[model samples]
Target: MSSPVALIATAKLRREDIDAFTTWQGRHEAAAATFSGFLSSDLIPPGKDGHDEWTLILNFQTADQLTIWQHSAARASLIAEALPFFIGGNTGQAMAGDTAHDTSVTGVTGMIFSRIKPGMEGRYREWAVRIQAAQTKYPGYRGIYLQPPATSGKDATWTTFVRYDTRAHLEAWMTAPERATLLEEAEEFVDNMELVRLATAFPGWVPVNATTGQGPPDWKTALLVLLGLFPIVMLELRFLNPTFSAWNMNASLATFIANALSVAVTSFVTMRLFVRWFDWWLFPNAHRPADTTLKGLILLFMLFIGEIGALWWLLP
Candidate 1:
């Protein structure tokens, strides 16, 4: 896959036309979702100070995917349809820049849009680097994508992409004591903030229909996770623990190491593969749902049988 790209557009509106513009924006977003490579999209409403106007942010899996969407006739049709509503003169150009997306970035992302004080761009960027470095030291930290204020927008704005393995870790860093100090240090620069979480954790990797909604039901997710994690846990327990035990580590530390190793295996290997196998279950829309419930029930029963068999084999 190509490197992911952060594409943002800002539009200024006649205050009275906000409602009409928003309706058009929704249709536009729906159209964009049909295309391949689209990841997630968000809209930031204009602020009280009239700094940002309105912003539409989009994430694509690759630059090529973005280009395909950008040059598509469908996109052109929508823009043409909505041109009349841009009475306040669109400021979208200012909200986008040549922001680079890192291909290696996988997992959930936190898309943060921040507007800095007019003269604070340099200081804001410096502060951003420091905070990202600090966050890197924390667990689940993946990487970041920063887009500078566009030359055509109404204000000095920046978009930061924060990738994390889980929401818990993301929240931890956001609420950490260090973050308080970091925010204080940047108080002179940041003017406003808008943050949108990118994806539901990993079970979301189930490539279902293109949607922004939460992944399948909690029970479904729990079942799928259990399916993916169980064998990984069993295999590691059977083979890997003895290797760690040779180091004569304490029971608590040894268990921790085993857990960490197994979780890593689950996240990167098993879960990735299992999602494909369960794609029909995850994305019922892609296939007929006539017997989905039956399939799921049968699979659960099979898992029940397998568990008893595996236990019999390993117990001795």
Candidate 2:
């Protein structure tokens, strides 16, 4: 069976042309939907404080279908219509599989776009390897994925996705003196660079507001995670441990199984239920009274106590 595919396209636009570009983008999406095997499309606009680049992701069932859409006359015409609004011509990269819809991401991600100077691709790649190595030495470093220019010839743009466990950890890597030195050295090979930070406590598990591109704050997410996780851990210790011991499973393997089950349960069942029940608390409106936060905290505290009390009775 063919793997799913996604095309991620980005365009830079001037401030004044945003409205026109948005209207044109709607037409573009309409045109794309007419193609065969098209699954879905998502438009991520620029954040309030970042680069003015808008990203559009298109998912299709197969690469052949995506190729057909890309090479079609309808897409060409739409691109031509939208070209006037672009500051720099649009660029795109394709990833195989359903990466576009991946929600298992657990940290902050930085999307870096760099334009390498002519004939410096080799040097830039070498630099990338070194910088990647340097970042791995830092605390909370997750991983990085790099993509070369989507098109052949004069287009030298490269896209990179770097992840760290939290915004503070990511910022530590980004603002470190080592990174600063690397950037200084890169000046010889790189013409321009842009970094966009995507902040989310639990990306796929927690919904991000379309306009704001943000999820609930980290503290709230942590508290919710604890609330959901505590019961699971307690129940595992009470019921699952004896079964594992009976099966002669070692501590390491038993612990691994327990963690895996906990993560799966939290991700699929508990998190969803909690998010739904606490939607108002998770995303209170801007004008919501301050006590709204306190009220939610109090409610959570009560739930914690209730869980502890119930488990105490059930276990012992």
Candidate 3:
């Protein structure tokens, strides 16, 4: 199923009211924890500009599911609790899945952001570091990274990376009582922040895997293959061209070089196009299935074979 992307933004009401802000935020977090379809919320800290802004990025199964939370009584209560802490206000946007939205084919990636009180920034980081380390022992946990907010700002922010297997899986994690309580605890450190979620836009197909463990494509291998093709191509083009000039170079080493280059280029292009397409249609954590990868590679390789065969038949 395709997941809808949510972009949520929030900021503080006052730079000096950290204690009151944290208290109100804790209750607000509690309120959000009660909602359904609440996959994961990211609390992004204010960046270099000292904006005290926080972003919550969420993934949901569909717009309908998101609407449930949008219209929920709990959400109303949460907002009311957060009203006094609201500094700069908040805004949200939800994009419906088009042909390009697919998380099942391309992995989706997410980052969590939060703004800790100025003097409490180190404590907030300590909690995140320890909690993330403990969470890594769980089944769906992949890996994580951290980023600190600007020190020059009135509000300090921190960011962390989190991964899950699917939108459903992420929702399940959020729905847990333990997880909700952790959110409440985390809220105690922040004056105000937002949780913003984003997914790449692709058409029609969803990603199959969303785990960070799958790793990115081996660009080194692809680059080596391209580098290796150069010498072969030059040898055939320059040294063997004279000897096979009568046969249009089809019988010469250049033909092999050309075939190899074609294969390598085609594979590289196909992989990139596929990744780009998947990024658009699916979440960053999503992945195309193993069979899907095989099928794509086969199709690419066949195109290469056909090109070579056609050249042999027509030119020679």
Candidate 4:
């Protein structure tokens, strides 16, 4: 299923207000948790650029809950409390999906922005279903997402998203003769078509350069993920095993839940910590080749040493 509806907002913080802002943020999140349909939230701190901005991503189970929370007195009071910490007014965008919009670019994703011909909605949808099925045969195909026109809108514009593990894989799908034929098939149904790569700032453990609004290369992302996840998983396994054993729950289900929580912690807390610690390697001439590659190799070597040390110290 898709992710819950969410309001994603970012505040430019006063340099001196960082601590106070965090305190208020924590309180605000706690309040939000009390609301119905509240699922999860994450606090994204500024990057190496010293941007002084913090992002709050809040998720609720439904549009109704999202609206209620937006207009709730609790939320209003929290906003009023946070005003002094803001260097600038907050900016927000509402989105719904399996993951937050910013995080969706962890892989190479393509957006197909199209408008249907008037009175052709029925046929266009049929065509879309067929194309979606065709795409499943492609290698590395992750999934497709569809966003219809807003409520009560006449224009039949549709935003369709497709994702694959790598740009090369995505390109293969796009440039394939099969895809070309499919586009020809869809030409009359779609009045306008635009394809572009989605750029992202931060997704998860991967460092997406803030300045460029682009994610790090795949190798860098993989290595950094390993750097963070290796220790996190190991430590969780070592310390959490006893607690899991004590639980009356089925062992398989217990293990699954424990691992899931471990990953959630790694995504929301652990990665942010490493991003700050590895800022130098992540953002240095991020656009240039060899620069990041060389530095990533160095960090990877360090990670190897850290991994060995962790196993020695944490393992029985």
What is candidate 1's TM-score against the reference? Answer: 0.45
Please report, in order, the local distance difference test score of every candidate based on alpha carbons: 0.64, 0.75, 0.48, 0.66
Tens-digit lDDT string for candidate 2 (230-254):
9999999989999999999999999
What value does the lDDT take at residue 44 in candidate 2? 57
Model 1 lDDT per residue over 60-92, tens place: 677777878888999888888877767554423
Runs of candidate 1 with Cα error greater than 4 angstroms are: 1-45, 52-212, 307-311
Compute the lDDT of residue 307 as modeled in candidate 4. Answer: 85
RMSD of each: 16.8, 16.0, 17.0, 22.2
Worst 10-residue lDDT window, candidate 4: 204-213
Candidate maximizing TM-score: 1
lDDT of 3 at 140: 49
Worst 10 residues of 3 by lDDT: 200-209
Residue 246 error, candidate 4, Å: 2.4
Tens-digit lDDT track of model 3 for 71-150: 77876776676676666757456655421212332223454556667677656645654455345334443333344442
What does the lDDT read for residue 277 in candidate 4?
Answer: 72
Ranking by lDDT: 2, 4, 1, 3
Q: What TM-score quantifies how close candidate 3 is to the native fold?
A: 0.31
- Any runs in candidate 2 off by more than 4 Å, and if so which? 1-198
Ranking by TM-score: 1, 2, 4, 3
Whole-model lDDT, candidate 3? 0.48
Considering only N, C-alpha and C atoms within 3 Å, which residue pairs clash in candidate 4? Answer: 3-97
